[model samples]
Target chain A: MKLEMRDQPGQLVAALQPISAVGGNIIAVIHQRETPAATETLDVQIVLELPEGRLSRLLELLREQGVSVVRIDEERLLYECTLIMIGHLMHTDLSDTVDRIDMTGSAEVTELSLVMPAISSPSSARITIRSTTREEMKKAIRILRSVAEQKDLLIIEPLEGA
Target chain B: MRIAILGFGSVGRGIARAILAKNLDITVTGLADSRSGIIDPAGIDLEAALSRKDNGGPCGSLDVTPADVVAKADYDVLVEVTPTNVDDGEPALGHIRGALRRGKHVVTSNKGPIALAYPELRDLAATNGVFLRYEATVCGAIPLIHAMKEGLAGNTISRLYGVFNGTCNYILTRMAEDGLTYEQALAEARELGYAEADPTYDVEGIDAGIKLVILANTVLDMRTTLDDVERTGITLLTPEALRLAEDQDCTIRLIGEIVPEAGVLRVSPRIIAKSHPLVVEGTLNAVTVETDLAGDLTFIGKGAGSVETASAVIGDLLYIRDRHVQGS
Candidate 1:
């Protein structure tokens, strides 16, 4: 089985022990040390030789342990979505803001490009995130909205037709 | 949530792989083919299904037939991936309408039904209180459907344009560069798996034209008919004309351009300047949307692929799931 785990500190270790506990053999790990140029997180596709019957149990155990598991199966499908966040992207502690959304474990803010204006004005940013589902995207947006509220920055989503 | 895929072809098989690979919360409820749909609500063994398909068995040979599968099944999502006829999105339309009628959310990649009968079908969805997502119809893997449905919902789109047909563009570019005749370029494209054996849909611009109608209706909020827009296929371009385009530093692209000029809506093809961003995207389909507030925004990506298209299916699945949760 191959699983794409979001790149974060201790994610690899966390994902390993559960499989190792189930006596799964580690075939190969493809975690490039160098971060991707566009995204902050790397897609770590781990190939594991686990017992046939224990695969589902291993997946459940990983989910219970809060691993940011993107996909898990023979072959994985990765979906990436780009969203633009306007208003004081920096004033609200951008790193903390990003971290909160990353904590969802369903998705990670893979890429963040901030465009701050001169004279300390409000900022807008294009945040490219990858997730397994659209629910994760909405969850990420909710997390961003909470952080933006604390920073008093207005969050504007793409307008919907009436 | 439970999911079922009818017609285990490229799309059905690809979506099945996506769902199993992702290990999502939903369970595989059923699989329907010509014979009938197979229902296994608890969960399905994916490897076994693939093995059955590999052995040249019918789609539902794993467990049951398609007729029995749909009748004896209860699915939250019914994915219809049947082959579509240009004249009528047929069997697929029947499956989708049946699914919606049965109160199941329908998702499909079939463009024929959507381009021909979206308004009437959408009205049915509204009446049935279900969703009908067809992101894979226009541009596979690209989130154009989501972009219009959610991202730019507030803005009134004035016009939409893009290089929608990959086969035509590939043939044209090859004709321009390799000096191959239309037939030769089309043969190369067919050999490369870019164009179908009967490349009429791609070459005649019908495929792109259908997608253009969908985009125009949704984005511009205009009710456009297939007859309203003037269509010209790349089949008309000669090697000499393509050479002239090259001399002028422009590429001949089968562009599905829709602009609201005064009171009329226009969708047609024309040469784009080399400096244009779309020209640089080469081979990859790109769409530039002009909106009232958002201005001009361009989305570029792999417009066709089973995996990418499957990704869109998964997205719609999650969206419908969330809505189900919220409504509950």
Candidate 2:
């Protein structure tokens, strides 16, 4: 996010404090003091990672701090879960399984590693799914589970918080 | 305290051995196997019964039956260590009901009667002014039911889950440790007496599912049965699936979980981090109970074995003897 605030000593600190308050981690801050001295506004660019649904609160906090947000670039998908699916992966239309998750719009199959041993034996694959929120991740898993059931596949999900 | 024991299987024999080895001040007045039974107002000779069972013979005379011991035995407590019949929880169920009606305290390691008819049996026990304790039904030596009922009585339990089946745990542990296929590991388990010849009950997640139903219905105040559980077994799990979990420092174990708030009872192969407390190795069972006041408590112990299960039964027996029994 790029911020425009008054050219003051404490304005930079004021802009950065709201990031931590909203439980965000500031990755890098690109601030240049060599802006032309004609205008009283200073431009500072910040790279941050905020938890899902905190971006709006962060913007409100920044506005309260008398800071103007020029531009915001968002990374929507922040939650990732990995699961292993075992069955005849190739025979069961694996691409269709991946397509079902991608069709949810809020979650997508990001990475997959497949191992097919032989022609007649069952195969295994590890699927990594990224979702915009935890709830969406759960929904994605539900869809995958239904698909696995239709295909007679085994899905092993992570135990934590499931 | 005088007690009558039914079922001369491994669990019943283990309890007899413990009583004989220790001066627990308890007398067994009646004993029975499936075919025979013995009843004496004075204590029965447990040493003789043990030798008789070991020699491929009925523990007592063939004419005497288990129902006779339940009805006519002179005992304050009836120990029902019979095998579980999940369909109707019969014989054990009938035996427990008879003991409770006679105003006798009941201690059982059988999952059938408790899981299938906990509420009815509980009300009967309360009406008759007796205690119904089943500590060895779920995890063998963990004393989970006792802890939840006695030690953590006031706390509200929200979630309870764990590795409930030792046979599945042993298979998964071997699969991850030695890179054995599911069939090979299960074969090895059968050879080592960890699994039965027909391992369907254990490997298909029904065993874990039944245990979950027992916990949910008995402790969590949830009305559920084996059919209510969402189950998935490890039979279809490939070695590659385990390897995939291994790449991320995780392994798959059959986990049985219950969330009372969400009305969830699930048994499936779940990927767990190696560092997690519930990730017990081999035939060990681990359970974590999340409560409102006391936070989370995890219990790990030997889930199954002759003496281990006997330990849980003895704990329940002594608990009854201390609080309810008139004299030792």
What is residue B106's positional error in candidate 1, in angstroms?
1.1
lDDT of 1 by residue, B198-272 (tens): 887788778788888777665566687677766656664555445544554654567777766533433334555
lDDT of 2 by residue, B245-295 (tens): 899899999999999999999999998998899999999999999999999
Compare the candidates by DockQ and give the number of the best one: 2
Q: Number of the top candidate by TM-score?
A: 2
Single out the weakest 10-residue window by summed lDDT for candidate 2 chain A. A72-81
* Model number with the top lDDT: 2
Candidate 2: give the clashing pairs: none
Instruction: Candidate 1: list runs displaced more than 4 Å.
Output: A1-162, B62-68, B260-269, B280-283, B325-328
In order, the candidates keep a fraction of the true contacts of 0.00, 0.84
Quote the lDDT for B111 in model 1: 80
The lDDT, on a scale of 0 to 1, for candidate 1 is 0.70
Interface RMSD of each: 17.7, 0.7
